[model samples]
Structures are given as structure tokens and as C-alpha cells.
Target: MSNPPVCRRCGEPVVASAEQYEVFERMHYVCFHYEFEHQGDPDVECPAGGCPAAGITLPSLLFRTEGLDLAQAGNTVVPAILALEKLGFAVEHHDDGFAATARGSRFVAEDPVALLGLIKLVETRRPWRATDAEIDDALGRYDL
Candidate 1:
């Protein structure tokens, strides 16, 4: 028998028909939905000219010199913590608020273009996950 397709995002076997697999880009429906369709914090829109979330970065949210408490983090920041955590960029510290991990700090310091590429991909391709080549291509296409 042929091997079942694996989801590109979560690395799980996809239980879908050939056409469904093609439609979902080999990801589970739920995984595809979350990565490509979930518009977090419906009430909050990114004020930045073209950002998907409010104009906040992992560094700005987690590595602030002054640090942040829950009230200071506010609605926009709180909603994004889980998504950033999923991306391995931040961790929540219960009532202490969120902090960036080593990997996340490196991402902020070393790869300024990564976030722009991610936003461009979500805006155009809606992939559950992107390969490096795909990110580069998206950035080029969008001139970001």
C-alpha cells in the first residue's frame, strides 16, 4: 500500500483523500486552518501598515528593558503570546508575563527579515509551514 501523506506543519500522517491532501498542502485540516486561517484576537487589528498582528515583535514584547506586567502587556500583547510561544520565540511566566528564549533572541538580533517574510507568506501563500526557499521567494515576490 502507498504510504500516507504527512502534514508539513505538525508532522502527523494526514488522513485525507488525494485531492484533500493537495488542497490542504499535505497538512491536517485543523493544522492548516490554524496556521493559515486563524486570525488571532479578532478585536485587535495590526495598526502597522501591513502587519498581520498589532505592530509588535517578539523582542518588543518579551525583551523590553523595563519588562512587562499583565496590565502593561494589554489586550494586543496577551493574545499574541501563545502564537509566539508556538513559534519557539517566547515563553510565558505565569503572572510575570512573557520572556524571549535564547533562540528567539538570536532570531531578533540576527534575522530582521524573518518576521517580514513570515507576514508576507501568510498574506500571499497561506502555507501551514514554509521552507526557507519559500520564504525567500515570498520576500522577493513582495519586495519585502
Candidate 2:
């Protein structure tokens, strides 16, 4: 068997440019990407041309796609936030909105799940924001 050879969204010719591409089953599309697992290069941009998914690093993709953002920190926060946003959680800052960091923003765009998650987590654990450990524990309790 061989890979299907075009952009499912635009019907454009797909190139073997990135290390891999993702299959957006909901959208019935296969998008090219530069993820770490199947990634070939870090410097190359995704071939989709202005695709939001292209902005996410491979780790982010895996994090969100796998639903693993319950408890995290550092670089994980960004991806976890992105994952939540992708899931329709409605993100916004405490005062602003669900925009990823400048670099993350470029990719995460208007995802709100992260913000929603943050708010919910804050409310549930008031007087104590979550640490990676707490999050992991909570996620585990829920079987994530």
C-alpha cells in the first residue's frame, strides 16, 4: 500500500516535505506536518500553506491528540492548553482570552479549551493552583 497523494481539503498535490502528516478524520483530510515522532526536519514548515495545525510542534500534536493535558507544567502547559482549546473548552486569560503564548498563539490561535480547563482547575483547587503532580493525579483519577 502507498500513501494517498493529495491534500484532502484542497485537492492540491501533496509533497513529501515534512516528516509526517496527520489524518483529521473529522474533516476527512490528511494534513502534512513536521512532528517529532515522524518528523524529518525542524526548520521546514508544513506544506498545507497557512494551516493552524502546522504551527503546532509534533509534541503538541501528540499531547492534544492523545488527550493527555490534565496536569502539566513548563512546555507542557502550552500544549495542554492547546489540546483543551482544540476540544472546545473556550480559552481566555483571567482577564483576556484563550490565546496561546505568542509563539503558541500563532499556532493555537483561538482555542478555548485551555482557558476553560485553567479556570475549572483553579475553581476546583482554589487556594492552590495545580502542579504537574496534582494534575497527573487528577487525570489518573479520571482515567486519563
Candidate 3:
């Protein structure tokens, strides 16, 4: 009818694309919007429309949840978000790291545990995840 839909992740319009999203769990086009719409994964930053990429590649999510100290979390958020973006996630670039829409957050909140969860999940895929330890430890690097 009026174009299938534009993918919010990437920055282009699309048609007939399978929108696969995984937040707390796997879901489809309709299920995703109605059910896990507002729920954002800790680190994952996938957009609502779609991954924006030709198709979804990374099929997982990893996150730390809300327990994270906002002030402390804010420090590691930027570099962490940047790392996720380099890995092909749709990051919204925030004052912290990235808020994540619905899709992107999925990958950041996958499984596994340790180091508040953020560094743990990402370490599974990207080595940069562990290196983030230095960043986290350097919280006093700047003033709140």
C-alpha cells in the first residue's frame, strides 16, 4: 500500500523485510511492537522499525538492567555504546552510552553473568568488552 515500512535502525525505507527482534526473548513484527516495545535491553540499541542493515546479523542481547548506578553507568555508557555501534547495532547515542530502542537492546542483554553484566555480555562477542574494565575502573577519570 504505502510502502511496507521504514526501518528506524538504519535510516532508509524498506519493503517485505522480515523484522526479527530479540529483547528478553525472540519475537516477530507484530509481537515485537505490541509486547516488548517499550522494554529496552541494557546495552542493545536496535531500533523499532528494524536493524536497518540489509538483514539482522547478531542474533542475541546482553544487558546490565537498572540496578546499575546511574552516575557510574553514565561514565561507561558512551564508549560502551560506541563499541556496540561498531558491532553493527543501531545505537541512538545518548548522554550516557545509548538508550537502545527495542531491537538493539536485545543483543546487549543476552546471557551470562559478571561485572554488572554489561561487560560480560559483550565480551562474549567483542574483546573490547573486557577492555572496558579499565574504563569502568577509571570511574574517577572525570567528575560527576
Clashing pairs in 2: 84-113, 85-113, 89-113, 90-112, 90-113, 91-98, 91-112, 92-97, 92-98, 93-97
| lDDT, candidates in the order shown | 0.53, 0.47, 0.43
What does candidate 3's lDDT look like per residue over 9-93, in tens digits?
5434443343443332343444445454634542344555443221223443322232444443346645655655555556453
- Name the candidate, 1 or 2, with the larger lDDT value: 1
Model 2 misplaced stretches (Cα beyond 4 Å): 1-71, 95-144
RMSD for all candidates, in order, please.
15.0, 14.0, 15.8
For 1-144, candidate 2 gives per-residue lDDT tens digits of 565455555566555532333444212233333322224454434444443445345553454457544544455656766665565554445444444333233223333444445444543464656789989999989976
Q: In TM-score terms, which candidate is top?
A: 1
lDDT of 1 by residue, 1-144 (tens): 887898899988886544598787778776666567656653343333333343245443333334545432245454455555555664434353334454434222222233323433454553658789989999989977
Task: Supply candidate 3's per-residue lDDT for 43.
Answer: 33
Sorted by lDDT, highest first, which candidate order results? 1, 2, 3
Worst 10 residues of 3 by lDDT: 107-116
Candidate 2 CA-lDDT value:
0.47
Clashing pairs in 1: none
C-alpha-based local distance difference test score of model 3: 0.43
Q: Any runs in candidate 3 off by more than 4 Å, and if so which? A: 1-72, 93-105, 108-144
